[model samples]
Every structure is written in structure tokens, then in C-alpha cells.
Target: MRKKALKAAFPHTLPVMAGYLFLGIGFGILLESKGFSFLWAFFMSVIIYAGSMQYAGIDLLAAGASPLYTAMMTLIIQIRHLFYGLSLIEKYKSAGKKKPLLIHELTDETYSLVCSCEPPKDVDPSLFYLFISMLDHSYWIIGCTLGALLGSLFTFNTAGIDFVMTALFIVIFTNQWLEQKDHRPAVIGVACSAVCLVLFGPDRFIIPAMISIALILTVFRRSLEKEASDHEDP
Candidate 1:
């Protein structure tokens, strides 16, 4: 079951593997540039498993941030995972022992892939999801480790490399938009985010945007579902 799940899950993760390798390398190189070694990258990648947070953490650690401050920062950055967990609650309820690992490894890439891709017939859904999570996690760890090793040997400017993360997210969003016929949720999210961005500014926008989006969706869940049903029927 595990081997079959691994094989079936590999193709689905190719895109994430590519993106994570590059992003992970960028993070590793950045950390290396800050005087940390490959060991730091490896451990952080393995433990944190949060690409963006790890990148941000390099600076925080460098600055000698307090533990309390670090905790708050991590919560703010990863607040989206709360929503991810909510969505997958039912799907993961019966995963037994694997449920803990699944939740721990639920990175954005893994969530997107698992939420969108179903396990093939004959493959256990839990195992397939586990493999997807594990594979993506491994790619990130390897990429960061390789990058740290290479960072010391090569010295090049890395000014715009961070943009790769942003680009990956845009690509993901675009793909999701294209795949879904009911654009209401997407439109609401984008519009609300834009309004919040303008109102709260970039530094303070995310929380408000998330709150507004959640509230709006919750309040109108019935209508939205009905509208979606109407669209499919029509």
C-alpha cells in the first residue's frame, strides 16, 4: 500500500518538488549567507517544515529575537493552517496514527495537492496523502541541504530570488481559479483581500482580510452552495 501510494503520489508532487527545491535552495543560501551552516538548514527544514517561516526566521534568529516574539511571529505567519485543518477535518478524522503526521506536514503545497488530487483506485487515501506530505517535505529538506552546501562554494547576488515564492503562489492561485467553475469564492476572496490591503496596508492586512473572508463565507455559506448548485445544474 505504501509503495503503491508513493508511486501514485509522485507524479502529483512533481510540480511541488520543483518549486520547493528552488525555494528551499533560496532559503538555504540566504541562511548560509548569514553565517549559518548546512546543519542549521537541515535541522530547521526538518523541524520547522515551513518554507516561508524558515526564511523569515533566519533574520529573527540573527537579531536574537525573544522566544515569545518568535512564537507570535510564527503564529501570525502560519494562521492559514488553521483554515487548512478545518477543511480537512473530516477527511483526516479516520486516518488513525497517520493523522498526526498528516497534520504536522500540511504545508501549503501539500494541502493544495492533497485537497485537489484524489488517491487512485486501490490506493489508500491516507497513505497517498501521507506520501504526498512526506515527498514534499523531503524535497524541501534536500533542496535546503544542497543549497547550503553550495552556498559556501559560490558567491552570487540573490536580490530577486525571494520573488520565486510569490511567483509559486500566484501560479497555484491561477491554477485553482482555472480549475473551479464557481468563481464566487475566488472573487470574494480577491476582492476582500484587495479592500483589506488598501484599508489596512500590507503589514496589517492579512489578519483582517482573513477574518473578513471567513465571516463573509460563513454568513453566506447556504447561498453560495445554492448558487454553485444552480450553476452546475444550469
Candidate 2:
């Protein structure tokens, strides 16, 4: 049954495995270029475990960015998790003392796996889900360590690896576009980000755009739900 559950969970790992390898490798190379070692990359991936934020973390760590800044930005980036947590509280309640840490491990891929799932009667679904999350995370640590070693040993240009993130996002957007019932949030997010970039300049737009988009979605959440409902009814 564990093996069956693992098999069931494997397909869901594809996006994370692919995205994290590319992003992790890019992060590893960048960290190596900044004089950090392969061991450092492995350790960060093990301890930190955030994907996009880890990319930004290089700047934070290197610049000695304030703890207040780290706290604030982490809140902003992960605020959507509040809603995810609220919904999952019941499903995850039995996690005992592990509850808090499990909540912390809830990433884009992990949440997608949980939310998009139906619990099986014969298998312990939560344990299987948790195993998948841990495995995906371990792969990241390995990838980062490998990439750092590769970077140190090789002399190839890694400039193009920057697109690793962009390409991953594009793939995510495309996947959600296909399977997602309500496209408005995704549409709005892209539109808002593009508009903000044009108006606020690339460096200053991301947080502001995310904030504005989040506000609009929050205020009109019912309307978005209604829109999804109307489409379903039709």
C-alpha cells in the first residue's frame, strides 16, 4: 500500500521535480559564483526549503537584509497560505506536534497535491502526501549540491539558467490554465503584473502588483466564485 501510494504520488512530483532542479541548479550556480560552496547550497536547500524565496534569499543573505525585511517579505510572499491553512486544518489536525512544521512545508506543489486529491480508504493518505513532500524536498537538496559541484568543476556560461525560473512559471501557468476551472485569478495576476511592470519599472513592481492584485481578489472573492459557479452551471 505504501508503494501504491508512492506510485500515485509520483506523478504529482513531476512539476516540482523539474522546476526545482532547474531553479535549484540556477541557485546553486549563483551561490557558487558568489563564493559559497556546494555544501552550503545543500545545507540551504535542506534548511530553508523555499524555492522562489530561496532565489531571493541570496540577496537577503549577501546584503545582510534586515530581519524585519525578511519577516515582512516572507509574510507578503506566503500570506496566501493563511487561506490554504484554514481549509486544511481539519484534514491535517491529526498530525499532532508535527502540525506546525507540516503547515510550514505546504508549498505550491504540496498544496496542489493535497487539494487536488481524494483520500483513499486502504491507504493513509496524509502519510503518503507527507512522504511525497519530503522526497521532493530531498531532491532539491541533492540538485543544489550537484549543481554547485558542477559549477565549481566546469567553465560553461550559466547566464541562460536565469530563465529556469521564468520557464517554470510559464509551465505552471499553462498547467493551471488547462485544468483550472476559474481562470480569472490567473488572468488577473498576469494582467496586473504586466501593467505594474510597465508603470512601476521592473525592480519596483512585483510586491506592489501582488499587493494590489491580492486586494482586488480579496474584496471581490465572492464575485470570482460567482463567476466560476455561473460557468459551471452553464
Candidate 3:
């Protein structure tokens, strides 16, 4: 069952693997350029495990940000995970011993893949999810470590490499849009974000955008679910 689950999970994570490795390498290089070692890259990828926040962290470390400030910024940056976790509570209720790890490793990419893909025949859903999480995590660790090592050995222009994460997100969003017949959720998200961006500016928009998206989705959940069901029917 585990073997089958791993096989099924690997293909779903390939896109993420490509993204994470490149992004992770970029992160490692950035960290290394800041005088941190490859071990820092490996440990952060394992312990912190948040792509965006980890990128932010390098700046924080360099400036010697206070722990309280770091904690607050981390919360603000990762607040969207609250919504992600809420959406998955039902799906992960039966995860048992694996629930904690699942919650720990539920990055944006992993969440998208797990929510969209299901286990094949005779494959345990829990195992499939776990395998996907583990594989994605490993890719990131390897990427970050390799990037750090490369940075130490060679000199190259490292400007704008951080944009890889943004590019990966665009790809994920486009893929999701193509895969789902229902576009209302996507439309809602984009509209809310755009409005918030204009109103609050870039730095302050994320939390408000997330709140609005969650509220709107909840308000229209029944109708959206019905529409999706109708579309799925023959």
C-alpha cells in the first residue's frame, strides 16, 4: 500500500519538485551570500519549511530583527495557512498519527496537489498525502543545500532570483484555473486581491485580501458547491 501510494504521489509532485529545487537553490545562494553556510540552508528548509517566510528570514537575520518582530511578521506572512487548514480539516480528520506532519508540511503546492488529486484504487489516501508531503520537503531541502554549496564554490550574479517563487505561484494558479470548471473562487480571489492591493498597497494587502476571500467563499459556499456539482454531472 505504501509502495503504491508513493508511486501515485510522485507524479503529482513533479511540478513542485522543479519549482522547489530552483527556488530552494535560490534561497540557499541568497543565504550563503549573506555569509551563512549550507548547513543553515538545510536546517532552515527542514525546520522553517516556508518558502516565502524563509526568504524574508534572510533579511531579518541580516538586520538582526527582534524575535517578537520576527514572530509577528511570520504570522502575517503565513496567515493564509489558516484558511488552508480550515479547508482541509475534514479531509485530514482521519489522518491519525500523520495529522501533525501533514499540517506541518502543508505548503501551498502540497495543499493544491492533495486537494485536487485522489488516491488510485487500493491506495491509502493518507499514505498518498504523506508521501507527497515528504517528497516535496526533500526536494526543497536538497535544492537549498545544493544552492548554498554552489554559492560557496562559484561567483555569479544573484539578483532577482527570489522571483522564482512568484513565478511558481503563477504557474500553480494557471494550472488550477485550467483544471477547474468553476472559476468563481479564482475570480473572487483575484478581484479581492486587486482591490486590496490598490487600497492598502502591497505591504498591507495580503492579510486583508485573505480575510475577504475567506469571508466571501464562506458566504457563497453552498451555491459554489452546487454549481461545481452540476458542472461535474453528465
Model 2, span 1-234: residue lDDT tens? 778777777776776787677677878988888778888899888887777777777777777899999888777666656656867878887867656667767876667667665656776767767766776787688778887889655466655764644664576678778888788898888898899999989667877777778888989899998887887885
Candidate 3 backbone clash number:
0
Candidate 1's displacement at residue 8, Å, is 1.2
Which 10 consecutive positions of candidate 1 have the poorest summed lDDT?
A: 158-167
Q: Residue by residue across 3-99, what tens digits does model 1's lDDT show? A: 8999999998887887788788888888988889999999999989998799889999889999999999999888878888998999888899999
In candidate 2, clashing pairs total 0
TM-score of each: 0.89, 0.71, 0.88
Q: Model 3, stretches more than 4 Å misplaced?
A: 152-181, 228-234
Off by over 4 Å in 2: 63-98, 108-125, 154-168, 180-182, 229-234
> TM-score of model 2 relative to the true fold?
0.71
**Candidates ranked, most accurate by TM-score first:** 1, 3, 2
RMSD of each candidate relative to the true structure: 2.4, 3.9, 2.5
Q: After superposition, how far is residue 82 of candidate 1 from its true place, in Å?
A: 0.8
